[model samples]
Target: MTLRIALRPAPLLLRFILPRPSLLLHQLPTRRAGHGPGQRVIHYMGHQAGATQPPTPHKTIHFCSQCAGPVDLKFVSSEDRWRHICSACSHVHYLNPRNVVGCIVEHEDQVLLCRRGIQPQLGKWTVPAGYMELQESTAEGAARETLEEAGAAVEIVAPYVHFDIPGIGQAYLLFRARLAPPFTFAAQAPESLETRLFPLEDIPWDELAFSAVSLALRYYVEDRRSQSWRMHHGVIRKQAGAGPNDPGSFKLTDYMGLPLGAERIQTQA
Candidate 1:
């Protein structure tokens, strides 16, 4: 026996319904209630193509973490600067500079350098370094970054350089480190395209990645030449008429030791 199947149109209630013109007029409210004449009414149905968009929030932080409320920039008396404050909860969201920790691993008069596989300066050489994680000391972060990037286990000797980049809201703490026993390292890691040791006289100054790395290396070389090892503090400021990635774009101002090509300004004790 053959079975016959028949096709039928969908029921009227199940069909797509377009709103009546009068019903649309009542349902779609263009102007918000209680607004006086001459006030702007945001039309939700209007085409907003080619409209100017709002500026992006700094560091991509647009909402409060505690209450998930919309945040706006307001002057905080305690901070003495504009900070993001929650509209509903009145909570202040503090935006602070981030710390980057790393080590300058030294072995037999040579320093370990890694070619970055990531950006901001991809393919450029730098000492092993990355952002510091919470619950870890700066020295610990340095050793961990060194091991992860250059695959070398190192004993941090001392904090060598404290460099600040105010323009980018970052602080770099670089330490002098000695390679552990056996003095071996993997040629590359996940974050590094290549790794090599460069002697003091053979450092690729022009090919170095960040200003902080270059400045730290310069301090190390200067100290090595004088046979004196001391901690250094400095700030890297972007100079006018120079691009961010330009080698000569940044001016290094040393707060402790004398920086290259600049005389130290002495302050009265």
Candidate 2:
């Protein structure tokens, strides 16, 4: 009984003096409005990519940080600014013009097409496309638009095709895609009024949006054999009767009698 030695617990005072993990965590303060677990809560309020943030007290339009585009600031009834964002791209769009992205979708030997139910090319056949939104890769924008406009999913081929429409202040990024077999559109997607498929010969040349589309089509005909190409102003430059078919071949040629401009395409061109 005498062998027992008493050990006292650490005094409460000593425990109270020790540093706790909670205190360290408190050092990192979090903003009251976190965008999400991983996202930062940023208010578009009046800012856009390629534009400056926070209006100058009474300014209406702000610039965007990403593209320097003008962000339109609309005041509510009380003159309070309102936000309008593209649901697909999640960018704080300014009142500036929009950028369009498109895809030349393919399955088997045929092409995917859509007929316009609205004006500015209404009742015309064109590749799947629409406006590009904020915070989206060019290719992703192309694919997303293809699905929204046509209600189909596709696998994109490498190296996007780029085009700039002069005088219209429009830029285009087009992608080559392989349509997911048995493709169809999703419900409630309102960008397009109608969707259809067609053979290359059936493409509505008289109704397509721009010449670039025809250029792309001509390039694809040539691409099946080789990737080297030269396209200008929405026209396919093919040598006279260079492709599998001559009826649609180039219309011009160079000094060497080589088909020049969009007129002459090579065989398999």
Candidate 3:
């Protein structure tokens, strides 16, 4: 042939060959053992910004984050939305939602959970998760907390559930992960009294620390059975006549029906 020069592949094809930067940062596990590509993906359900109940003054609001002056909850704006505003300095102390990261670490057919030894829900069972720290991705925070609480290494699979708890101004990001080899169990975490793996049939549904934890576990079990998993994201609203700190009132009426064996944890005074 007179002209038989080979042409390079197009840039778009090269782009398709490259891995996603964000996906690489998650540190996905080598073995995608659980389900299909659908199950291994993160599907955004949706988002909602429900109004939070008026937060109680935890203590004497004697100072502000901005000026350290005396502050109190009042209508800082003409819109009638109450906020913590400084009376002395007129600085607004905008309260923000606290982000908590946790994971459902699966090994074979079992899931790892931790028993809390601290307040809020002391002695109750929960997936290993806690307040997210600064300068870390959600997956990193979840892995760190899982290691600290369950003493196990995990590779995050995908974001499993997102909870918008306006009642306490808490946003929970729960991920699905795989337990690394040599799965270790240690109650070394100060906040955790014990850590253990539970089969789907033996999960302590009645003793789960939070409603979202129970919901996530149930979803995990059901998804594995159907092999048609998808992300779950929704808002949980406080029940009428319930305070911001009251866990008994939080329910997912707008999401899937109430989780199995649901009961309110008696709020400690």
Candidate 4:
């Protein structure tokens, strides 16, 4: 007797040319994970790089910022997840994912990339990006990071990709940008060892610093090749049993064209 496993067809890519923000929010299912008892994991219908693992908190909070009091992890009933609650002042310290803003600095047919001088993935190439600073818009932060790391002033074109790495509590907001007037750049030290432009076909895929960078570059190349630009949303997750030193993979969960009349914001120098 012979036995075979039945496989289902992949889900169709849901595209919305000019979807309303409210409609998009309502249509997309929320992906959430919990660390409490009997946690449930939600996965979107998309291409999976490998086996998926439940989301984990990026870091543990030990003390409350409000009163400098010790905090304990407790499951909040309203939020339906665990949070660090202060035992002294009763202030709840909510841990939310951080926003990492960056830009894909484009000029002519080449894109700018920076080699890292820091410890994490040192010497690997990546787009200029870092944690968002306080009192700045996402676009402004992206541009600021580009200048700091790549020493290039860029004009924000449009929002490009929003990729969430829930396991590390980071949401990368990458934008498509072009070099401002003068079109000059250099590698800033400490943060970057070298900065250079690479044609789309010449991108150093094997030496990319992070999964987020690799995914963003791949999507950019795909859009350019097809001459159809779109905003992308997705997640980069680590495979089961993958260690911290392992290079993980990413999943493209959704993509959509910008809504009509979308306005471009100028990057603050």
Candidate 5:
């Protein structure tokens, strides 16, 4: 917790080239904790929140995004990986990780959280966050999501965490933001049912919408307790091997060495 730093916008693709052992990840023990009535806990992360993985998407792919032509999954251009290629137009559709931007809006000792009104975790609580839009910076997208979901304005502070869930094919960018005076919010977005602020102890850890949300809150609370904060970059992958505590089960690696505010980082090693 001694480290304290921030990051500037960099191309997300650069992450793949970084050494695997350098990315430190915090693992969440598989749990069967209470999730209310009629809900069965899933083993892997990224199964929830409509964050499905590639090659085998959550939604069936019948047509290509580039062209309306019928698409088929097949090896393309001597590439080992199978891709969604258009049958008529031969346009290959490359599926990449989606970027989700959001903020941890802090006002004094309280942090804002919202109750989701949508699936796949309807009624669960989370910090205001959602998919990033085209042409919008991560910070701007975070601010926009805060206003849209919680109906609260926030001043972007600094990058807090960059979580990669390869199982879901998504990356989350969370910023530490400040809420303006009055600290009022409404559940304006259709995705949110309600919004409220909670002390660190009172946060609903078990009812969080995603594991990343819980992880972020835990990190924030820990940082406050130690009076130190640093930007976090990590990944969440499916449990591997059989042993409960095996290194292969949950690998925690250090983050890539991309400087905080670089204009463009090399993607190739």
Candidate 6:
């Protein structure tokens, strides 16, 4: 594996925009044939390169962090495409879905959500979530973020939902929580446009930036009633037209000529 890079953060929105903190730690594929769990993996470069298209993300591989040894590469076709396993220690350097953590901070039947005043779905609504900081627990990150974004104190209730996907390298973890009574809020200006507590019915489904928020809400509702719930991938659910060797270069955004939220965030310079 010639490309030797350290673990990096997830995309801007996944890290900075959501309300839940989800740190997706994955084991690397192993290099040896008979191996233990958590070993790292490496996918040697094949002769045929996909130059004219988006690089096949699945074909990507990783190497040993210390020894620079060859790691294993185990790529499941459907669900597990996101992780690159190390063949040796089964060590996993999770691909970027960039650990996001947020709380479902609430009071009675109402939920808390924040409005974005910044680019990348600016003016859209979502929870008070963000990327995990070094030396903090996921729950800590979530609780701390809730206070910062909403400017309201909160207590985490229970673990609610998790959105996992390998290809796009993003995951989400949300918790049920209650805002400390006497809820007080300020714009927190740039991070959010406004923060409010709303009854479940008042949530604006149409204007959410990432699809995971709605998916988490849906799962939360069904979970409450003992209804059969499916594990939703949130933003990175499988697509039907994808080929085994398909390069994920083109999509609907290309057709509509819409600007990606990241693009807008960059232009704000």
Separately for all candidates shown, the number of backbone clashes (residues 3 or more apart, or on different chains) is 0, 36, 0, 0, 7, 53
Model 2: lDDT equals: 0.50
Q: Per-residue CA lDDT of candidate 1, range 79-112, in tens?
A: 3456788998989878789999999999999999
Which is the winner by lDDT between candidate 2 and candidate 3?
3
Ranking by lDDT: 4, 1, 5, 3, 6, 2
Local accuracy of candidate 6 as per-residue lDDT tens digits, 128-160: 888888887676777778877888666555455
TM-score of 2: 0.47
Q: Which residue segments of model 3 deviate by more than 4 Å?
A: 1-60, 240-249, 253-269
Error of 2 at 213 (Å): 2.0
* Clashing pairs for predicted structure model 3, backbone only: none
Candidate 5's C-alpha runs over 4 A off are 1-60, 64-67, 239-269
Per-residue lDDT of 45-75 in model 3, one digit per residue for the tens? Answer: 4332354544544543568877778888775
**Model 2 residue 29 distance off true place after TM-score fit, in angstroms:** 60
All models, RMSD in angstroms: 27.3, 25.2, 14.5, 13.7, 11.9, 17.2
Q: What is the alpha-carbon lDDT of model 4 when measured against the actual structure? A: 0.72
* Superior by TM-score: candidate 2 or candidate 5: 5
For each candidate, what TM-score against the reference? 0.70, 0.47, 0.69, 0.73, 0.69, 0.52
lDDT of each: 0.70, 0.50, 0.66, 0.72, 0.68, 0.54
Candidate 2 lDDT, 199-225, residue by residue in tens: 766766656654446545655555544
Ranking by TM-score: 4, 1, 5, 3, 6, 2
Off by over 4 Å in 4: 1-59, 240-248, 254-263, 267-269
Comparing candidate 2 with candidate 4, which one achieves the higher TM-score?
A: 4
| Number of the candidate with higher lDDT, 3 or 5 | 5
Write candidate 5's Cα lDDT for 1-269 as tens digits.
Answer: 01223444554532233232232235321122122343332233423443333354343467977769898877443444568778988887778999999999888789999999988688899999999999777878888899899998777766788888776678989988888645678997678999998999999876887766777787788766766665666675546332222233444333322224422211110
Candidate 6 Cα errors over 4 Å, as ranges: 1-96, 224-235, 238-269
- Tens-place lDDT per residue, model 4, 71-120, is 88775545445677898998988768999999999999899999999978
Q: What is the Cα-based lDDT of residue 163 in candidate 3?
A: 69
lDDT of candidate model 5 versus the reference: 0.68
